[model samples]
Target chain A: MSDTARDRILERLRNAPRQEAPRPDAPASTAADPDRGARVGRLKSLLEAMRTEVHVLPAAEWIPRLREVLQARAIKTLLYAPETGLGAALAEARQQDAAGLPELVAYSETVESFKERIFAVDAAVTTAAGAVADTGALILRPTRAEPRLMSLVPPVHIAVLAAEAIHPSLSEAMQDGRWSADMPTNLLLISGPSKTADIELTLAFGVHGPKELIVFILDD
Target chain B: MANEPFENNVDRALADAQLRKNFAFAMGNFILKRRAVFSDAEQTERLRTIGHAIKQRALSRLPELLEQLEAACTRNGIRVHWAETTAVGNRIVLEIIESHAAARVVKGKSMVSEEMHLNAFLANHGIEAIETDLGEFIIQLNGETPSHIIVPAIHKNKAQIAQIFHEKVAGAPYTEEVAELNAIARNTLRRKFYEAGIGLSGVNFAVAETGTLCLVENEGNGRMCTTVPPVHIAVMGLEKVVERLEDLPPLLRLLTGSATGQLVTTYVNLITSPRREGEKDGPQEVHLVILDNGRSRIYQDPQLRQTLQCVRCGTCLNHCPVYTRIGGHAYGFVYPGPIGKILTPQVEGLEKAGTLAFASSLCGACEEVCPVKIPIPALLRRLRDESYSSAPESSVPGRGCKQNWAERLAWKGWAFLNTHPRLNRLTTALLGLVGDYLPPAGPLERWMRYRSEPKFAPRSLHRRIREEGIADE
Candidate 1:
């Protein structure tokens, strides 16, 4: 990234509206809904039906569980976060895995560094604030740590979503447009694996985005 | 250039029994499936109404809608550019690549890009633009324009494609097996996806409310082209806008069902902006280039404005008997069909492509199947009228002129006979006398070719009625 481009991005970020914290007194509408349990159950069943494995955990336990999954799979996993502790946890994981274990990578807020990390890793795991129950979509506010290509180019994708973040419909998701202002230049609503039927209407998987998607649900 | 006339291409295609068989089979299945899907007349009418209303709403408030869309997209970090012409559209895309200092650009199937000939333009500027859509990729490798709008290489056979792949890709063995050939293309294009610095796509619709660009494709290449590359640029015509996200479903249903007889395309990507935080896999930088390209000029003409409502389902071509016989190449435009017959002349100018208007049989099949209900036959007639008026008198064949002369004389003689009963009787008797004197088949046969000779009545109406005493009564 050129200095000018970096400066421009910084300036844009500085001028961007600060994200409003969730109302503390507000009811846990998403989590408390009677349908939330059913939705998650259905999502798990659907994923299982598609031959994908699902994992459930608390948010506090996600980082460790993901590291374990990546190690078991023997594939390089890159974690993207702007928070300092998240980076520290990833680094600690790498140090623990020094004896020829799976590589654990972490990206920060710098676009160039983020780009470098994305190209190096085979799978990407990121956190989404919400997931749409209707279409099995995960919504994330991507930043430098989660470069657009990271989610796409990798063969496998794991998106961790907080239980309270799930939305019932896209319309409800759109109602929270303020959260979208900080959105990257592109917002993709990916339902399932990347697939194509271009050649003689034959379905082929993994043309662009991850062919396999694993959603990790976490109770906040 | 191939040094082959359009007719020669048609002849070659006609001779290819396999290609004809494949095309006929596909077209027949598509027609049957689409008919079944849209069996309910009332539902189809409602869908058409909704689609037309949405398109009309977008067109009426285009400037306002575009600004709203731009604002929403920009807030989400997507860059929006406007192009006034094809050259500008191509230039804007090339500039996006140059800014990234990209050496290679991988593109998904985009008809607008093809219309702009952006690949060649980019190649001239020393940037490689590889098409990623299988049909488009095959045609691109062959260095030919798309024969059909939906199926670019519809005129080609499997063997022909295998030969092209073998000749183009070094060390690649020829294979008639579909799966092996697909694997070869996949392996070749997979590298391009990873290496290309930029991706280019075409927009199916741009939602003004959310500033989202929707792309519907059966192939995952569209997803790859838009997501794998760091930077993504989408070029769309100005007419491809709809007012709200709610309007998408109906249009999508109609487009999918009418185009390929699918319940829905395998993939429907709705990109609001670029990549956001904590997201994996999407373009970091997204640029949208909206093109006008004489659309506003067409908008000014009420007779032709309905063409803007076309969703490009290609049903018109499939049902067009003439198009099925001659195929798409003879029309000589990016769009080839009944819609092309009207649109090409308007966009490229009537003087340049006037004869295409005369290609139709005016059977009204295209108008019947058109999803948006564009009055194609009426438009064709208007184009023909324009062609005739503007065409030079010397350009018309002498045989046509002779037929016109005979028709005019026959009408004049009928008018003269109507004014005088005695003259009518005399003319009737003269016709009988001439018929008796003429040889069975000689010069009269040549005259018959120019004008049909009416069979002589046995007796005049007045004489027969008088003999029957009906006149006295």
Candidate 2:
């Protein structure tokens, strides 16, 4: 039934008198040299305003910081992807932990098998593909190793970001990453923890997705 | 509510003090937030211009771009469906659900579905469709349609929501705390996400270059609905398609900033396909349903084509004086505010919905804040003229619906007098003599409902200028 509907709709659109409105030139190219320092500060303040926790640390200190974040929050189980480098390190760290860190669970199987377990985990840690400075967002391209639900289903989402991955704007991030040519099955730009101001315009966080978003900005 | 007269709806809404208070507070906050984000006038103007251009470009070649989008989506393993009207759109969705043998469906916020009245359609077929957005959930529980596009339950205060949740959700306790209310919704909806056989959402932008459906949302329910369920179906107005991925950044910025004053929403999900091989999660089947409804007819006219350029930012609603006072319910449509005034009459026909065009004060606030520069006030004026026009060339549905002999004759007489300078002058002089004694009744009564009648001066402005020896030029 809709085959004809498609043809009919497209036909109508084509037959319609064409509008001769001028097409605008491409948006002005962003500045060639974006001040990375100012962007980082803006990103930090923006995230903080949304109640997301941001920690700046040397590259080698993220693991320790991650442990502290888990301990401080008293997370019982931490979901991770064992295929990623950070995930392997987390596994190794969990193995050596005599101080009783959160139990590590690998999301290695299909969601059909891991759905209940992933949902029950206290927190999940994922590596952000990149970050947008202007909007203070963390971009995640869900690969086979780290699926789309990791950052969403868990109560707390802890993302690790290298300082260099931050872009001045979303346009720059898309252009620099060549997103248009090679797109992922699912891409996410998450700015803050899940929130809503629906009822009487009263702001509330952690409505459905992660209640807490903690970013570890690794300054290399 | 859908069948009620627009004026009666407005009267009832105005009479409700609580509704008035809710709208005032929410609109004020929305204005402040939008102003804060777009504080730099030059930058904001550039962005709006670029946004408007992008929409126009896409619309100028809407047919080719839609074909490109369909081809790209097909290559990505996502099935595409087209519907000329809402009935077909709803039927397509139902068939998809039946194919999955799904009885329970969880939905994210999609105004397109609201336009279809999809929930009611599904319920009639014995399919339970649950709304997962917090605002949507509250309104769904109360058996109400969304009052605002962005905030579906903006018409209801927290107390009213507490009452609805208490009465609707099983074993739920009444609480006015916003946090507690949100927690209740989260707890109730998460299980539905995990268990529902199908998930449905609305597309914010469909990229022709990449076949990606982008959803901008503050809540993660959008992510959850598109991810957790085994099958995901997305519905969009065909006009939401963009020609390229780069078109998204500016449009997204304008939409969020203008709608809620956010620099970026909490999540902007770009879905190109279902879960790929080796993926552990995400929906395995993704379907995109594009509904034309009355948009194709609307696109036939060059002037009305600009209406298709809207990004559904809802900023116009926040800034509209009429919307602030009467709220969304008074509009009696899927959309409300200035956009609705011009859009509804076109889609539903002027005969039934033409009165909405008269609801606006033509303040131009809506156009000033429109992200895509839709020229809403101009469109409103156009719709008003269409309602009264007897021109055969007017293509609008139910054109000249409001035309009557009384109004036509009055306008004709006024035109004739204005064309004859001597007679117009005589009439003015006579009005200056007796206008003050004219009764403040009849048609003037409605005009003076909230205003005082102006007393005409004994001398006309033209006479005063001549007596003062002012040059005619």
Best of the candidates, DockQ: 2
TM-score chain B for all models: 0.82, 0.97
User: Per-residue CA lDDT of candidate 2, range B1-473, in tens?
Assistant: 77988778988999999999999999999999999999999999999999999999999999999999999999999999999999999999999999999999999999999999999999999999999999999999999999999999999998889999999999899999999999999999989998998999999999999999999998899999999999999999999999889988899999999999999999999999998888888889999999999999999899998999988889999999999999998899989999888888999999989999988789999999899999998998999999888888767899999889888899999999999989988999999899878887887887788778878888878778879867666
Off by over 4 Å in 2: A1-3, A21-23, A29-32, A35-37, A98-100, B461-468, B471-473
Model 1: CA > 4 A from native: A1-122, A125-147, A158-184, A213-220, B1-9, B32-44, B67-80, B99-101, B176-180, B218-220, B227-230, B261-267, B271-285, B318-326, B361-371, B389-473
DockQ, candidate no. 1: 0.14
- Candidate lDDT values, in order: 0.69, 0.91
- Sort candidate 2 into its docking category: high
lDDT of 1 by residue, A1-220 (tens): 3344223322332333332222122111233443777667655565454334577777677766776677777775554454434446656765766543355555544434455556456776666556666435566554455555545656677777767776664545655554333333455555555654444444456554566677788864
User: CA lDDT of A32 in candidate 1?
Assistant: 41
Docking class of 1: incorrect
Worst 10 residues of 1 chain B by lDDT: B393-402
lDDT of 2 at B436: 77
Quote the positional error of residue A157 for candidate 1 in Å: 3.4
